[model samples]
Target: MSAIDVRALSSVPVEPWRNGGGVTQTLATHGTEWRVSVAQVERDGPYSRFDSIARVSFLLRGKGVTLRHRASVIRLAPLTAVEYDGGTEWDATLVDGPVTALNIMTAAGRYRTTVNPIVVATIVPPGCAAIVIALDSACRYSEPDIGTDGSIQPGQFMIVISVDRPLRVEPAHHGAAPPLIVTIEPVPARTPDSNF
Candidate 1:
């Protein structure tokens, strides 16, 4: 089991010519089965349609963006994630300023994820996975069994632990800042017939 420090995430520019929006990739199929990317939406952009992918977008900074899908419009707020079919028509409108968000996309039938806040002393059950992000500048995490202990500053995110193991979360230390946790689950495997 390994712990991924969110602060260490590398930033890659989002090429609109390629995916219809500006984005920064943290992790993807290159290192893991799922793709994790972050984007900063500055203005109205083209609607994105990914026929074979599933995505969850979490608002990180600013007032957030207005997500338009077909005839539906959803207002996403900081600390909340909106899950939708990647193949559907989707667009965004920045509310007050440039909106920052964490986007997780996985090829269909590959993986799924859950994003939420973790209060201290919470024992994340086995088979449950999570990504923890520090919403402030002084948040810390500790796991006794895994020998994992660290802190996350404001604007930093960590991919806590993979789906292969169980996890536990402790509340932030006194004066510890707020944070967000996201859990991911990989799709089951498909076995091929040897006779083929």
Candidate 2:
């Protein structure tokens, strides 16, 4: 985890959802507790239920999409994210056509993940494990501490830093779009019955 792990979307194999409504290319995962992936939403359908987990999704491509969650109709657009209880009964409707998105899910009571739009030249805070996802164009990054540097094209992403260690991230060059910064942090310990 200390060293960077770069994963390309095209290099990752696509796996169909259990319901077969869409497909996903897993980018990174830590056991069953949390996972990051890019999903291709080919059709509107019910989302699979994942009890005890919370999901955060970012619209990466396509026109947009809307979700019927609880009593609310949530809309999402490119570069935007929405988080909800993973077990909720929800269905998706394409705003214009098929869609692609970045998805992060963490087991409730175990971990938490946040997706934010970061400005170029910003340094990742200490003790933060992060993923830089290229959105609109290719971008480069460097970890001076490790003397390592790399680049990822649009739609690709890289995971750097460890939970125990922090690293600085600077944009290598300018691009049309900024990358989506995904920060992973652990939740405080909770009593067995506290989350229930």
- Give the per-residue Cα lDDT of candidate 1 at 124: 57
TM-score for each of the candidates: 0.72, 0.84
Q: Residue 81's C-alpha lDDT in candidate 1?
A: 81
Q: List the residue pairs that clash in candidate 1.
A: 6-157, 6-158, 14-23, 50-87, 120-170, 120-171, 121-170, 131-182, 136-154, 137-154
Q: TM-score of model 1 relative to the true fold?
A: 0.72
lDDT of 1 at 85: 76
Question: For model 2, what is the alpha-carbon lDDT of residue 57?
Answer: 89
Give me the candidate number with maximum TM-score: 2
Q: Tell me the tens digit of each residue's lDDT in model 1 across 1-196.
A: 5545556443434444354456555543325446666666766775467788787888877787887877888777887888877787777788878777887877677766777665555555556456766555445656657677676666566665554444555555546445667667766677785442
Off by over 4 Å in 1: 1-6, 9-21, 27-32, 146-148, 153-155, 160-165, 174-177, 187-196
Off by over 4 Å in 2: 153-155, 161-164, 190-196
